[model samples]
Target: MNTKFGCCLIIGSFVPQTEGKDMETDKVKQLQAGLQLLEENGYDFAELTVQFLTQLSEEEFQQAKKIIQQSSLNIPVCNSFIPPQLKVVGPTVSIIELDDYLDLAMRRVREIGGEQIIFGSGGARTIPVGFSKKQGYEQIKQFLCRCESYAVKYGITIAIEPLNKLESNIINTVEEAISLAEEVNLPHIKVLADSYHMDLENESFTILKRAIKDEWLSHVHISDRERRFPGEVEGKEAMNFSKLFLILQEANYRGLISSECNAASLVDENALSLQFVKRTWSTVEGGIANVKPD
Candidate 1:
């Protein structure tokens, strides 16, 4: 297999057991360990979640940045922002105030030597239950445009992810995200596709393939039907990913596919999941290696 076509990224969610114990000390160590594992196993990059940095103080963020800069790993850090609230609201930060948070977050990313930052289109909490789809879409479009303005300053591209209907009623499909991105009309704003959400919506891979507009697809997230490791679960569910990869290859998409699944409960089990993902990528690329380059 051509190793260049096998580039994939592993996210913190994939290795749930190994992170956030001390929050301050263990966070950086766990990220470094994950990056090492990715390099040793042949992956090209490791996606990082910024919520890990939210665990540290401003000064601690600087210290963590220094450590990341000093590492020998070639992994590129892709940043992700968790919604303001977890399960329920304690003290919520409004979307209107998100720019301030984004400013701080982007500064931290630059200080930490990261290039890309991923953001979610407003969550379920942003809209009331009785809100109309038309109204919800309008609000999301406004927020995305505002975010794009800030994103352009950092020379950072924001991959706006659309969560599943179960997670958020607004922006539940790729079409919706693409439409919003078009409305924003900014070079720095784009869409991200997550296989987990695609499964939840029962959306066809063909439909997703046709919907993707060039340059709009900035990133991808992959996982199996149950949000488990790739290749662990067999049958039609696992086979669907092959089709997804084929579409990506046909389009000549060249971006990171971050494995964002909760693969296992232990660090060792998660390591196995990472290995499984690499093997699957090899198989997928082998089948399409003959395609002519564009």
Candidate 2:
């Protein structure tokens, strides 16, 4: 399998060096820092959180794109975080109004020359706290279909990410995400597997390996057990990554594997996390290389 490395820009990586004054300026600085880190680590791509990108003005967004372009990196994926309010069905049915948002988001991706949009499954309150499993499945299917329509227009793919139960009750497992993608019946809509959420859900790596189809597995988010730098966790690390890498190889997955996790408290520890990812990816590549020809 071809192993690719990427990172997600969030609080720690992107927030500027201000003691905590104007959040906007701080965010730009943080993003700039993140770009530098990606360059230093030799990451091939970077995925920006939608929350941060949405806050940027056109010029700011262009500036970010220019910086990234000038770097030794390529911005291939942009994951949009659907705010909690937008997902709920309250007075603001923003969740239902995804068409416009998707159009704008896709346009931005095109403007910045990105390939995929990672869609967060609906938020906690979008469905009733005690909503039936069937109802949840149907709502997700509908949402994915809507996203698919927008994706088709811009030649961009939509990757559905299943958060852990703590983050979201709906679509909390790779199985759930796969089921929804299948139900949506759109070639452009695919599943995204994040290691952090998988750990939270206590899902077995084998299950994810078997569940992801070659075409449906669109993206990957890499993080350790504690959502920290990779080496911080121990035990069967190689085994877990080996399973995923082998499966991806068999499935012929060519998407980006992004390091998506909180790094705020680990600001000083960024290099460690970045190094860990590179090393882990090297291990994965080595394993793939050793696979004997049938």
Candidate 3:
């Protein structure tokens, strides 16, 4: 399997994470800066949030797509597909409005060569108070199907990302994501296994094995327990990519595994974090090479 790697541009930053302060850079400059750092650090592609497309108008989106096309590296997958401030499962949700937004987003994402769009906007999907669980589930299903309509037209797949409970009330596990995809029964709908969310939920690699066997896994998001880059935190808190990579390699998985995490700072040490991820993967791949074919 040609297991490629990428990092999320929206969540990853050159500046340290801080509260009450959002770092805003134009998409062109952001892509230029991130692609340079990631390419130097041995990354294969860059991931951007669909928020960048949603934030722009028709003309602006065209220009943004141009910028992405001109980037030194490919933006293969765009995460955070939903509009940031829009809710999909609440009394306040306007499904019609959201549907329109999804259509526009899919068109732009298709133009920009993003094959997969990650649906992991915790803020957008969280069921608000007073909404029963049943209502929330039905609403989310409908919302995803609507997105799939656009996806089919624009030639893209939607990877349903299961966030931890703190971030999302629905679809918090690989099983749940699979169930949702099965229920929706859309060819363009798929599942993503995010390591941080899986760890927070106390879910096991066993589920990932199941997902792989069923071919439900479309993409992967890897990070340490604290949402820092994988392999950065060592000792007791280390992210065990060894077993996960073995599962992926044994299954012959060929999909994008992205670093949707933050670094302490994106200075010189950022390259080290990216290298740590590559080295860990290389070690696991080496182990796989020693295993005799059954």
Scored by lDDT, the top model is: 3
- For each candidate, the alpha-carbon lDDT, in order, equals 0.62, 0.68, 0.79
What does candidate 2's lDDT look like per residue over 65-171, in tens digits?
67666766767788754655455333334653566666777777766677888876355235665556676566567666776777778888888888887766677
Task: Give candidate 3 regions above 4 Å deviation.
Answer: 11-27
Report the C-alpha lDDT of model 1 over 11-71, residue by residue, as the tens digit. Answer: 3321234444465566667666665665665555556675665556777666667666665
Q: Order the candidates by lDDT, highest first — what do you get?
A: 3, 2, 1
Residue-pair clashes, model 3 = 0
Of the candidates shown, which would achieve the greatest TM-score relative to the real structure?
3
Q: What is the lDDT of residue 64 in candidate 3?
A: 62
lDDT of 3 by residue, 1-294 (tens): 267888887632212223432333355466666777887777888888777666655665666667667767788798877753678888889877897888877877778888889888888789888789899999899898888788889989999999999988888998999999989889999999999999999988778777888888999999887787775688877978888887887787888898887644555456777778777788888887887987
TM-scores, all candidates, are 0.80, 0.83, 0.90
Model 1 global lDDT (CA atoms, 0 to 1): 0.62
Model 3 clash pairs are none
Higher-ranked by TM-score: 2 or 3? 3
Worst 10 residues of 1 by lDDT: 5-14
Rank the models by TM-score, top first.
3, 2, 1
What is the TM-score of candidate 1?
A: 0.80
**Model 3 C-alpha lDDT versus the unseen true structure:** 0.79
